[model samples]
Target: MQLFEHNPIKIYNSLSGKKETFTPIETGYVGMYVCGPTVYSNVHLGNVRTFMSFDMVFRYLKHLGYKVRYVRNITDAGHLENDADAGEDKITKKARLEQIEPMEVVQRYTVDFHNILNTFNFLPPSIEPTATGHIIEQIELISTIIENGFGYEVNGSVYFDVHKFNETHEYGKLSKRKLEDLIHNTRELDGQSDKRNPQDFALWKRAEPQHIMRWPSPWSDGFPGWHLECTAMSTKYLGEQFDIHGGGMDLKFPHHECEIAQNEAAKGKSPVNYWMHANMLELNGQRMSKSTGNTVNPDELLSGNNDFFSKAYAPSVIRFFIAQSSYRSVLDLTNDGLLASEKGFYRLMDAVNLLEKLEVSKASTININAWRQSCYDAMNDDFNSPILIANLFEAAKYINQIKEGKETISAEDLATLTNTMNIFVFDVLGLENVVKNDSGTDKLTGAVNVLIKLRQEARANKDFALSDKIRDELAEAGILLKDGKDGTTYSVN
Candidate 1:
């Protein structure tokens, strides 16, 4: 909760197109609404990466002692099948293939999404409002947009008047796209039977004869449009205006841009103070998306069973990997990167363990202030997590050296180290010792293996005394050992 002297806490605001100091709307409180997954299929690694990034922001705000009302919506309905309004509902398509009801598909994937996020140790949002849960609210929002003359109802379908919204407010403000460019590249579809412009999107889509999800609204029996849900849900939960609105960078173009227009049309003001976007996760330098045929499921990442991964990676390792990069930058996934991150991740957790066991000295030899300052300085610069992590690794190296009697720390500095790490690493960044279930047994096994390797290296280097000493030290650590044909075998006694 302590804001350090070096703390700046700058955030990249998409609205302003600049990194700005993150001051909350309400004093000491943050109202954040992030667009959740559509839940029409298992969440891809790309989606997981975005959520993890937001989790860091959410966790960090809470760590700052800010009262955060984080609202993430489950798009059980309202989201379109594609960016265009022409495609079928993704959930309905999934239901057809799975031979189940659309709601059944929603429930299954929604549960799956939660399971994967929980495995990653992400805290649940303050409120998770489903679009299906707020049909009336969405209907009311569409009505307001229509009443404001920014939308029109055609037959049973209601579409937002984008050409009209652009007259008063910059429609492409969020995406930095020009209206003329959109009109030029825009593919004219058949759905615009009554739309005022080709660039306009739906607020409510009239249900087709075979449509699975439908609700009776003032306009007609239909479902809400994809962007309408967020506009409705955020206003309903976080009020008409909120602190931050975030989602994947891909959503910035049409989805978020449309949401901005819808909110402004209904409320006469922008819904969010700041627009935050986390970049996509790429595989082999290509975006990992369903359309790209390179999507990696969270289950694959957790089990490490995907063709892209050699071994299973823990959820914390995944979180750390994403956090090591700026939220606004695309994160490339590589086998070597994960391997390097695995080592870095364990090294970090190892430092946390060392801090808990360190015996504080009366006087310090290490400069703890410099380390603390560097951490704050990095985090303050637009949540530069990679720099913060590098600083943390430096502290870890110092902690390890101190543990080995090669360095020293004062009692006060030791307490600072403990608290600093607990705040930034665990609380703010939201990394957990996910290996705790196997930590006790795993630690002993790992130590024994390391000692055996060291002893073999010593023997190879013709250091008999060092090899003997290594074996003796491990024995004291409750690991009895026997010389083996292969090398040495160890067992905990």
Candidate 2:
């Protein structure tokens, strides 16, 4: 039986504004599309949260035996400053400032984005299509919209007629805004804009003579609009309608709303089955914004080089911190929260390691089947990772009891426990054993051992200050030294 049939999965659908049961277009298969980074600058922590949430969703779907074709597009072109479809393209602006070609900026930041996501252990999407690569597809989509009478060409640029489309279909169903409200609330662009209505977004922008990124379109020598690439790329990879379309909650208004209008205008039906949105992440109770200097980069957090964190944190700790909360809720990044999660993560992993050393008895004390089912129950209820983690902690308590001989488990129950923990912790959660066994770890161990010997000699020689100095310095560097009956053992905290 398919996993969802046995253990049904529910997802919070932003389109419907409810938690709906996930039913794929085809049985036993899923096609998911998520918006990727624009590759103009370093990705912030908020972007990481959105991507990680989808990564968990992707991993869980695969774990449930679904064949998932996940497509996340790279916005290397057509993404503009302010997302207003008026300013210069982000990649082009960055290139002008750096005195290099636009492709260089895209290449540099795209590599950085991949490296950061790799550090967080994110599973790469199945198809990573780029906006620049699908220009022909975008042009075709624009042409179809025009031929369908929902788009118009003014001068050299093309704009989607939001007023015209809304006459037949609801334009703001996904965002839950009426056309009247949108028209009143829409901000007027400065100077003479080509759009008939401020709410009508660009389908194909006419490139200025000095614009660096320009292509040959039927309307003009121009580039695709900010919102056109996703519709084209998603329809190209997945069909006109797919299982899931996801992005950060901030994209819900103009970007995703425009996408819906474009697709519905060209095609007769809505393009996505379920619209999933990951909530924003905040820093110290305020929204993260780079302009206000209230943002933290992934590299800074991992390297502990920023003023926000007390010490360096492993990438796994950050990932575990994110998993502690639901993706639909706003997560505040605080030092205390991260430190607490760090302790919890280590405790969980320590129990998993101890499971192998646990001794089995003749009879089991706990119902292994019930505990296993609860894990699935938590995941099935809209991917409630926080609840799943609570269940994992309960399993950890049981593991500890088994280790202490306070509880007993039969061989079969023990095997189930082992598999359950492995699947949930490693495969589904995407967490790693951050403890390294490579040569660098060995080298560090050797150096620390030399220091331990020096400290021992200092103590023997009654050099109290030297021994205390070594201990205090190591502690400050996030290395905990445990002085046991068998000498000293050090661990990175």
Whose TM-score is greatest here? 2
Clashes of each: 1, 0
Superposed by TM-score, candidate 2 places the C-alpha of residue 204 at a distance from the truth, in angstroms, of 0.4
Residue 207 C-alpha lDDT in model 1: 83
Q: Candidate 1, overall lDDT?
A: 0.83
Instruction: Name the 10 consecutive residues with the lowest summed lDDT in model 2.
Output: 433-442
List ranges where model 1 is wrong by over 4 Å: 1-8, 82-87, 434-493
lDDT of 1 by residue, 406-477 (tens): 788888999999889988888878888643221335666676678778889999999999999988887897
lDDT of 2 by residue, 373-486 (tens): 999999999889999999999999999888767889999999999999999988888999764221335777888888888999999999989999999999998776767444
Clashing pairs in model 2, backbone N/Cα/C closer than 3 A:
none
